[model samples]
Target chain A: MADWLSPAEWEAVRLSLRVAFWATLFTLPLGVFVAFALARWRFPGREALNILVHLPLIMPPVVTGYLLLLAFGARGPIGGFLDSAFGFTFAFRWTGAALASGVMAFPFMVRAVRLSIEAVDPRLEQAAATLGASRPWVFLTVTLPLILPGIIAGTVLAFAKGMGEFGATITFVSNIPGETRTIPLAIDLLLETPGGERAAARLAGLSILLAALALVLSEWVSRRVAARVGGR
Target chain B: MLEVSLRHAFAGFTLDAQFRAPPGVTVLFGRSGSGKTTIVNAVAGLLSPDEGRIASGDWVLLDTDRGVRLRPHRRRLGYIFQEGRLFPHLTVRQNLAYGTWFAPKGAPREDMGRVVEMLGIGPLLHRRPAALSGGEKQRVAIGRALLSAPRLILADEPLAALDEARKAEILPYFERLRDEVSVPILYVSHSASEVARLATTVVAIEGGRVIAQGPAAEVLGDPAILPAGAREAGAVLTARVAAHHDDGLTELDAGGIPLFLPRVALAPGSLLRVRIAAHDVILSRERPEGLSALNILPGRVQDVRPGDGPGAIVALDTAAGRVLARITRRSAEALGLRAGMDVHAVVKTVSVAAADIGTSGAG
Candidate 1:
């Protein structure tokens, strides 16, 4: 294990896991709300909302990072307000890295959850209302369970994307060691050092293993939920 | 009791309906796309009508004039849709329990065991809805509604999706619910046979209007009210089994008339309702001899209605009750039959098949 991961590499791996986990956790509930709105609700700016959600997917990663920095930088309006209200800072910090990763991975999460919400039968919701269940109760008991497989799929995909986020994280947080240096940042640093080809290879292998494990776990969880819910 | 008076226009069709339903099953009889479902949905609080007043007992469910529109859950009305609509994730027990969870705290608990036994769902409690047959799923759906302790039960063609055998299997359960449960029921159906067998009060709806409303027998027997007039028109008779004969016949005493039918397994003194189809009755100008038909009742022509096709509906009032006979125009012309004419109505004992007989009163 020591040969597989040096002390500095292990720290990077642990920090990357923490950032990915926090990013997925913070984005899931908002993702579900946005997905539901996109799937079921009709409004004046629905098309505009769809385009805005998909902008992160089409825009260059560095451009997205620059936009995030402009909006959430220390001197920016939102960043200044947040710092004053909560005594928090995002410029060149681990939290900034997490914010950038979450923004980059949000589109993937929203699309998966949106498709699942659309696939649910609306008639079932109407039936629940006729059975004396209110709208919220119907969603909790019927619609949520029916779309749980999709939620898990979206979560895993977002986590995997967060784990590999590089351009946005490095651009926003400036690759500070023992602070914002994630697995991708560490691998980049190793590639630039002298006689560091073997270290870069090791980090690359570790990233591949983590990504494969995330894929297998997602498949297993989604299949188990689908089987339990009696997939339509 | 239920009172609904409403008017609404949708797309190109206009719905103007008003009716009163007393205790027992009041059926909204009409064809498909005739606003039958719309009325029920309005009462269930799923659809808010433009101008309407709905009241059940003293509770005002909806009153546009008074600015009251109760939510669907607050209405406390149970609705059994065409499809069973069982929660896919819940087992039979869970589905039944889900209904009871929302019931008012002070409301009496409808016995879950009794509902299970009534619906014959005891063996299916642990099973998911996906594993049950269509008929079984419908039964569970009914049981779920009952456990909620609703003020009224609205069933929209509950048996429309089932096959003949499954329909036969579930019809008895609905009959029992109508008789045994104290709650009033509003049933919707287009099948004349189902209305004949189950309805206590029949509301004839055509073109989004209540054309006629009265007792099932009176409404179904009226030649002018029913579209089929004489050919498919029938009168519902409530009778009691008097005896079973060894010669393959069952004796029934309805009102004051002794009616004989083919062999049926009901014991003596058991109440039954029989639907005598109008086309099966042969009207004779007099009591003729050498007739092969076993049953003959002497009566007078109460009315005469000419049908659109080739037949004429003749209403005969016997000592028992009113009976309808469908006779062709040729026979009517040859016999010179008209209103107030005395006649003998002949019915073949074998024509009254066991399937046409219901074991409960008009409910």
Candidate 2:
């Protein structure tokens, strides 16, 4: 497989996996918290918060990416603060691609988790409270375990979206080879290059195989989680 | 003692009630939507009453005027919900241990081994709640609450979700808990039989107010106040197992009167409560012989309260304590049954089925 593919192609595949893994991992906790709050709590501005969380899903991927660039760019307030205070940067790097992908996939993750949270019986939580568990303890022991399958589904969906991200990654990180170019970006490059049809076909085939594997793995994992949670 | 006084106004209903439950199983008895559950919720700290105070033992759980409201967790009350509400994600062992894991330091804990054994849930330790039957789930829920080391246990219609057989299966465990466990229980139920079988104190709630409250015998003996129509009203008698005869009869000493019923499944020393429905008793001015009824107790009629119908309820102060007899006005007139009149209260042996009997304390 290494002999058939150019080193650049292998690097894109590796970078895509790394970016997707990090994007999914870093945003999972926030996704659960936001999803739980939206699903269970009632407060003013709840609908607005819900709309804001879903904005990236409804907007074009390029627009989300552009918004990310404007807010997290080198000179932007958040980016500048992080650069000066934490010696960290995200502009035009693989880290920037991960951020873009994570933002783009967040809505799908939150929606999945929120639905699961909503399905949970609040009476169980009340029972937990009566049994001397504080709110946080109840969440950790009961609520989290009950919603594990949904979280797994959400994480896998986000990872898959991150792996295939094109518009957001290109707009935010500019598709630099090895540094930021992922499988999709590599395929795009191959398709545009002169007499690159065979290479483009190979990359496209690989992308399909990878996406299918992710989906199958996600389904298997979800089944195991649902079984462990004793959910029907 | 558990004292609760709360006032909460819903859209179309207002719950304003107050009652004191002594150290024992205090049952909040009423019909559905009659504020039994509301009072239980208030006592459990699950609902914050608009204004009131709730105290269990020495702990002041809630007091609106003093701005002292303990959260449900901090209140340290074990609550068994109607549907069990066991955590589906956890095994029985884990669910039972959940409350103990979070119990505050120095909180008195019920021995887990004893609870599991008494509830007969040892084999289900490794099983998840989904695999358990309704009765098993409720047993686990009760065990979970017990292990919480709560100051009080609040059971809100714990048997309401179960079938008759399941209810029969779980009732003994609750009786054991009531008799053996040190924690006082605040149980809510609409079933008169459940109250008669389990309650030491009965608070009859109706339309958000306590219509009657006293010892189970005192509250249950009056037919007019029973939530169930007079037809279902009965007297709860606390009796001791006197002897089990070879002839398939178990004799119980109710006060000093020897009452015989179908064989009961308890040892000779055990205390039992038998519910004799008002309609099951027949009154005679003099002792009658050759009657098939196996039990006859001499008593003086204390009061005769007639209903709107042709039947009248006669309260008796017998050697077996207080008993009620439902007879027709014609019979009352023929026997001239009145206050302070001596009579014989006759009861058939088979009239009190196994379902109408429960152990008053641990055997």
The list of candidate 1 runs beyond 4 A from truth reads: B227-231, B353-355, B361-363
Recovery fraction of native interface contacts for candidate 2:
0.82
lDDT of each: 0.87, 0.89
lDDT of 1 at B317: 86
**Native-referenced TM-scores of chain A, all candidate models:** 0.97, 0.96
Q: Candidate 2 residues A1-232, lDDT tens each? A: 5788888889888999999999999879999999998998899999999999999888988998888888888988888888999988899899999999899889989999999999999999999988888889989888998888889889989999889999988988897998899999988998899988888898888889998998899899888888888733
Which candidate tops DockQ? 2
Instruction: Output the worst ten-in-a-row residue range by lDDT, candidate 2 chain B.
Output: B223-232
Q: Every model's DockQ, to 2 decimals?
A: 0.54, 0.66
How much is B326 displaced in model 1, in angstroms?
A: 3.0
Local lDDT at A109 for model 2: 94
Models 1 onward score TM values of: 0.95, 0.94
